[model samples]
Target: MAKTFKYIILGGGVSAGYAAREFAKQGVKPGELAIISKEAVAPYERPALSKAYLFPECKFVMLLCLLSILGFFISVEFSIKIKISACLARLLNIFTLMSQLDFAAPARLPGFHVCVGSGGERLLPEWYTEKGIELILSTEIVKVDLAAKSLISAGGETFSYQILIVATGSTVIRLTDFGVEGADAKNIFYLREVDDADKLYEAIKAKKNGKAVVVGGGYIGLELSAVLKLNNIDVTMVYPEPWCMPRLFTAGIAEFYEEYYKNKGVNIIKGTVAVGFTSNSDGEVKEVKLKDGRVLEADIVVVGVGGRPQTALVKGQVEEEKGGIKTDAFFKTNLSDVYAVGDVATFPLKLYGELRRVEHVDHSRKSAEQAVKAIKAAEEGRTVEEYDYLPYFYSRSFDLSWQFYGDNVGDTVLFGDNNPASSKPKFGTYWIKDGKVVGVFLEGGTPEENQAIAKVAKVQPPVADVDQLAKEGLSFASKI
Candidate 1:
């Protein structure tokens, strides 16, 4: 018999969707693929959820106050309590709060079907179905019998495959792991899935006139703090690091955001650790206890410590390194005919010359596309070409949208307008290493500069005469 060409994809996130798309692009049809997901909804973008979802729903009190002020002409003493019975009610509340704010609210995003868990972004993996990929939703894979080339699902279904791709994304590390009692309660949540966002939304809705405390100062924590602050919730962000967003930004850059957040009424508590959560007699979280023996009074506590790979089903089938599945440059796992991508897969990066796990959505997309090529090459009896793409990630905070291209490994030439001015446009710095452009960091620079820097990062040009270039008052390329 001819080869069946069966390909089974585990986890219905962006990685799986992209992989499916790549496969379909290469003439792989419907019956040839299968996607298994625990979520009822498809994978969607998540970075904006913390800022967008929590904004209006969490700011019910502020909306009420504004409506009360505006309604002085309509009604003197009418009850105006904002509730979240549906998506529209929540959106109105968000709009109401934004009216009083200086920043415009992000556009409402459509939710997807595979995102069943709380705080799940439900828009990403919709393409899987649109592109004719099969999906098994609301199901979990129990274990993989690699020797038998079959896998058992939670529902006792066994699936045999010629090729299996694990795109299992990471799950947020729990605060309870750090010894917080009752941390498993519905109220205490780490923002990952849409359900988590909904839980936080409902909690903030109930305490419409109360405060929120966010644990951690990383991207998720900072973003959640911004969203809560935007909705007029009194927010205090606690981070163990000296400055927020330590992983992505320099201390000075993080301090800039800290000041900006503080100006927006978001209190940032640096050099602090969250020891545990304090629940009231009603069993609802009332306060967050810090390691400094100080109780931060809060109505809701948001844990944003970060995420670890959600790899349990194919545990023994694949070799793992530091909690991530190990993979070659071509995205192949330890097991023959098996592949992995997204947050769970740690593959070699020939570009940066290191073996690291990338958790960004862009990486997932690129890696998935690359994984397809590897599979196709393997099928054709040709060795797959090594995949080497530089890592890139970007985030928007308040008015600043910063993009970081390439990893900074102590080889960068800092440039651009580093002034903390709201009036002028921000610029960025370029990272040149060994005569090749390696990284770029932007502040409030022009789009042209940003694009030029990215292009230069890919191919670094020799530095020209500075004195003559400076006389023209031109772009960074001219000055350098």
Candidate 2:
């Protein structure tokens, strides 16, 4: 009998979509594939959310068109949007880049079977329809019956498969767990999703010049705070950490951004934590009560504390640590006939000598490709290649475009151009680890120097030999 190799990959994000593509490229027939998502639209890149580049309407339209252009394989539903002008401009830029990169259209012929989760209403569903991918909108997976090799959805639909891959990404963890209440209140919110962004826009417009409180100091918090400030909303960011972006940047880099935000009229309170809310008789959030016994008045509160992997659907089949799925070098889960990738999966990286899970777009894309290769190799009874791509992510804060390369570890060396009067300023820092290059973080640097520093972070060569890196220990860049 011929081998019945059916694959049921869960989730319809970038990693899941990439896995489907790679599987097809490895000769897996369309009849042998099925992708189930909690969303209704097909998967697309998501890193442009905070870059002031993606607009809501334009993103929806372009993403629909692109799905039609790409080969039909899977469907996704990601309904999120930014309502502010600055965020709108960012979305517009994102739409432009989508067109420029030809990322909207697929380069292959579609002759495969794919399905999406139900929640993908309207144009979001149109993306899958345009590509002829199967989609079940307004539905969700309830449980994975691994013994039966099937999954049951909330709508009582059951799907069975020969192979299973879980690609559900991370979700924003609310502050309610820590007793920061009133998030469910009408004006208080979390802007991690497009719906949240829309609600924020509507709330801001409804309040008619209301003051806002942003709780948290991470990426989402900082970006949202900046947007609120640009719109003239009296915004304040409260964090337990002494500096902003502590996880992504060192103290020196974060200090620069902290002042930059404050100078832009944002009230940033560091080394403090939000414990709960103070609501008025109306049951709406009126003030944020901090652990230090201080209270800040505000009309609205946005909780952007951070997020954790969304792995509830495959909890038992996948081994987890600290809410993240643990995987081997091949991105394989503990269960047989199953694999995991993306934000939900953590694997070892030979490049950095650390077992970590990356939440960046590049990591997801590369890991998906790696997982596909491993699947193909396994099919042929060969040893799987390790998923070992280095993680790199960047962000834009006001006028600064910060780029991080490689796994950030070990000590840092700051550098800059000495010409104080130079119109074009340049600066950057290299991450050195164990006498080797492990990462590089650059901002306001010459394009040539940025490229060299990026390379050095990747390979960790001796800076003493390079003239470009002569100013290795410059103290700092202009504070944020």
Best by lDDT: 1
**Candidate 1 error regions (>4 Å):** 1-5, 57-132, 380-385, 411-421, 430-437, 445-447, 460-474, 477-480
Candidate 1 lDDT tens digits, 1-480:
222338988887778766766787787876788788887765555554676656663254566666755654343235345333543564566577667754444334464322322233343445566656667778788887767777777888778888888888988888777667656544676887777777777777687668888889987887778777765689899988878877767765666677777777888888888887778878878778887888888878888888889878778768988678999988899887888898988888876677898898878877887888889878878876688776777776666778777766544444444455455546555554565456667766466766765655455554444343223222654333
Candidate 2, residues 147-182: lDDT per residue as tens digits?
Answer: 778888887778877777788788877776665566
Ten-residue stretch with the least lDDT total in model 1? 112-121
- Per-residue lDDT for 78 in model 2? 29
Q: Give candidate 1's whole-model lDDT.
A: 0.71
User: Which run of 10 residues does model 2 get worst, by summed lDDT?
Assistant: 106-115
Residue ranges of candidate 2 with Cα displaced over 4 Å = 1-5, 24-28, 53-132, 280-282, 321-323, 380-385, 417-425, 445-450, 463-480
Per-candidate clashes come to: 28, 30
